[model samples]
Target: MDDRIDVASLGWPAGLVGELDHRRLKAPSVKLRSARAGEHGDVTYCVDLRIRHPNADEYLTSTELHSVEHFLLEGFQRLLPEHFVSVGLMGCQTGFYLGFVNEGRSEVLCACLVRILEEMQAATVVPYANIEQCGNWRNHSLDDAQRVAREILARREHWLDAA
Candidate 1:
């Protein structure tokens, strides 16, 4: 397993998140998973993110939104522009929402999600100081955070191609 992941092959043809910030739109409160009965099925390829913030309300903060906004502009907008549907921060918890362009595309999306999780598992830690400032899931080191983000980006390319 390569410890350092290289995302130079997304075919994005540009730097991630650099030039695409203004085109993002927020899709508030999407019902992705269901705690209720009879609300599950056919969930395949998807980018289901489970955000873990200390204070759920802090998700409303510009910092948190900026993090997600950067992701949307960087990865989703460039890779899966046609399949992108909605992005909502989950209202019930520190989680978020993701709806694709088609239910049929769930299989590939699930694979990308799994790849992201795997890369995150392999990541080292970001220092505490930066974490305190960034307020991500933890005060992980920059390397760790960038690793995870790169995983997301790389898998995004994989998902786009597979879909």
Candidate 2:
């Protein structure tokens, strides 16, 4: 069976496609997963932070995950207002999937992640966690989100190491 993915065929840049192919051969790790052109000619990228490796027995608590979601959504919008699309929690509770529209460069995305993490670390409260903005306002923890943000920021240098 042919396992190779023709990322360029999917409208990804050749340089990024090469990098993605390299990462695919390595063990699972925290990094950007893939990039492809949207039907509307926009590009969408998936970021895998892997806060908890699949092999690990631990997972993020619901409250922490919820808070992190809130922080990321607000931070991304503030920092990458033109490109940010959405943010979603990984079902495994290990990390998140960040969606950005029309941005395909891994380096740029990685840098944005760093900025978001820095903002998250300094955040005093979870944005949009109030009754008017959140569906589950009661489920959130700024402390937990900050802690995770700190941990991830400390390892920022290795975010692109997967490639």
Rate residue 50 of model 1 by lDDT: 40
Task: Tell how far residue 90 is off in model 1, in angstroms.
Answer: 2.1
Top TM-score prediction, candidate number: 2
Pairs that collide in candidate 2 are none
Residue 94's lDDT in candidate 1: 43
Query: Candidate 2: worst 10 consecutive residues by lDDT?
Result: 19-28
Model 1 error, position 19 (Å):
36
Candidate 1 lDDT, 1-163, residue by residue in tens: 1112222331221232112221231222111231111224322222335433334343333344444433443345445666656656556444455655434233444544444444444545322334444445442244434543454454343332211
Clashes of 2: 0
Measured against the true structure, the TM-scores of the candidates, in listed sequence, are 0.35, 0.77
lDDT of each: 0.38, 0.69
Model 1: residues with Cα > 4 Å off, grouped in runs? 1-48, 53-62, 111-163
